[model samples]
Target: MQLIKPFRKLVVSVLLIGSSIFSVSSAIAQESSVESRILVNVDVIYPVNYLKEEFKKISSNPTQADVVQIGGQLNFSTIPDIQAIRFSRSFIYDPFANDYYNNRNVGGSDFNYSDQASTSNPFLSATFTERKGNPPLTLSFNSSGSNPPALAYNGTSCKDNDGCVLMHYGYSEEITSRNALTPSLFKTILKLRDNNGNLVSMINAMATPIVTSSSGGVTQYLIAYHEQSDPANNGVLMGVWTEIPVASGISSNSMLLQKQLKDIVQNQSQSPRLSYSNSSNSKITISNTRYFLSSTQIPLDQLSRTSLPPTDSRFMPLPNADGTISPGETTKPVIIAQTQSAKKAMTWVINNKVDVNGETYVQARYDSKTNPYSGDTSVDQTLSLLCIRKSPELTSNPIPEIAKGTTYTNSWSGGEVFAIPEVVGNSLLSEQNADNKCQEEGQKRYSLSGFRMAEFHDGIQPSGFGFYAKSTDPNLSISNVRYWVKINDQNANPWSK
Candidate 1:
């Protein structure tokens, strides 16, 4: 029993040692495999022989010469695990080829056909030729289902000169299932790079909702057209488009594809008009007569021309030649003529005893009649004249002080003026009574004041008044007193009794 127990223990020890050795060997093998894969991916990104072949193919005359020059650089460190790289190239037709060559004028001048031909270059191809390089050049690999499996190449041209580089044409591929590398799944990558093999930028991809992860790498080719300096040497024009093709597994392919797509979208041709819409509104008519130019009231001098109608003969009458009225002779029809000035017209009406509304009437014709004209017996006529001439001046005149202690004021220096006084006496007063009761009201210890009337002259005269007052009593205090006037010719009867 003892011997058996020792033998069993020995067997167990050997088995444990052997298992440990096997485990170490397996781990080493796995590490070596990973390293081999990394090296392969690195070589694919910098394949010297493949690049040379690509150059040769691009430069070939009739067979495969659409590519012009491949520019930019390839970077593999962006995605270290996947071996990502980015590249770009330009494409143009070979002008030196016998069948496809033609010297044509583009933008009023003839440029070598082999020179970089781009849309903005203002150069037109004499003959449209088939493209040689694969459009939307793609790289494929296997990777996690989430990672995209394809990458694409993008093309561009210089804006200023053919020799310069500019990105123009680009496209993106739809990411599909892990195993599928369909044409639609390819995309053109656009990237910026310096002379050295260093990436400057990666343009965004064009299509959206890329099903695959942004993992694929990118490759760039500079399409260059070689033109002879001498004009007579048959001018052999050639171009080359080169790119480093990665042969690593799916991860490397995914990295390159992502980079290429980004380049194509961000650096390629952009739409000139991003968006547009109609902008318009309903029409409006404005005129000086209909609307004022500014809130600031204008003086008479600044006013535009105003139109006045001719006076009616019935509204105005002139003195007869004879001293007495002729028997059976109807009163001479009053004749009124249009006047340029409002002051002149008012004077004529007052002095001539115009039969306004079939009754003789006159208001204060001048400054002398401010006390009320004596000859005009017709109250209606007098009131009519006062309404036309006196009230306007009263409302328009600037406020004047009534007395040292009183808040109300009056202006007697004016032409014709009138006002409505707020009598403190309880009884209401007629227009005639109010005029004569001024003294009575004054004697009663009640304040008698005149309020200025709005201005009334012709030819665009302003018609408004400004009044201000201050009092301790809230009810008696006048916060604001403004006056405005408009002609009421329909109700006016200057000669009515």
Candidate 2:
């Protein structure tokens, strides 16, 4: 009996240990199945090998190119994951990055990028190429110009020797470096052409030594071609470029997105409208009634652009901070200096094309005057204890419908700005006539997509929507316009590849 009892206890212990092992194994399998990874629609392709051979040839002696493909893409989606390629210059940039790699003949607006060095600006691909220096090597904005200017012997010529193709690149000065390499690497082949538009030379730009985020990197490559007397007729056009593949991340911090939103609102609450008054100019010719916004107000004995509400010139009474109401108080009030009759308020389109993020896009307004209040205007109101501190904003916004592209993932409409005053006053005799104190006034500027109007009234409509352009034709006018935006999004990165 004693022997049998001991054997039974051993069997129970073994069974309990087996149960724990199975639980752990199941958990591990579940976690593995759901891990996140990055997925891209296109893969990156580099031109390093071809470029290396071509560079060898150039060093032997400069020469013009034959037709070559600088950028490449799979005719169809390739399997597995997208490839990212990186391209590095033969040498590192100077501490100030002011060498010929970043400077030389480029000047004026083109050199504006040089000043961005402090911010570690990105090197963007040039939209177009130009010639510079004394007789600026015969160049034209229109590459196809029939009369090519004569090239200067002392002008911008082919580098190293006469056999050089002119190439343009966007550069970022080293203000600060995140060295987000891999993702920043790119590859492409240079296909050269002559003034008459014939293929002249071709070379592939190759890869560089692997660089980590710790050590900043450069974006560059080189080519040589015969200097054309009329380079415009013989100038080279840019070809395909591809981004090198890199391990994907969710990208930066989500807090940055939130901060961008707050900035949009803050700008709207204080931006101004545009106005023009030539000592002369009158009404319209057509039956059309042009609309405009006017912070303009009547200068009554006490009312000014700085007027407060109730007895002030701009807006009505604001509920007291304590949430108490006074006798004979009305929910709304009339101000003597208002730019528009509250009843005339209609809709507005407020923008001229401006840069947002890194591109230029315009906004599409939706909320009309009558429907303005329907929008969720939770924009914060700044309160100032002392005038020196930025005061709380007293503003409202009309809802907007922004333009979007297919596959657009999200939309953020900061809405249109509306400026008004606040007042806390009452009808009394001693404290009497309820002295209306003027609170600091402010303006709201409309901005979405990172840009707001630099000047106001760019799009002010008393009745219709606002846009940056204008046309006399009624059928194709703002009234006839309609806007729609579409969107798409994918997980930027996943735990599992």
Q: Output the number of the TM-score-best candidate.
A: 2
lDDT of 2 by residue, 239-323 (tens): 1111111221222331232232222111221111111111101110111101112222111111111111122122222121111
Write down the RMSD of all candidates, one decimal each: 43.9, 29.9
| Candidate 1 per-residue C-alpha lDDT over 327-437 given as tens digits, one digit per residue, 9 for 90 to 100 | 111111111122211111111122211223332222212222221212212121112212122234433542333212122111122322222233211111122323333
Misplaced by over 4 Å in model 1 are 1-317, 320-322, 340-480, 483-497
Which 10-residue span in candidate 2 carries the lowest summed lDDT?
A: 1-10
- On lDDT, the leading prediction is 2
Total clashes for model 2: 52
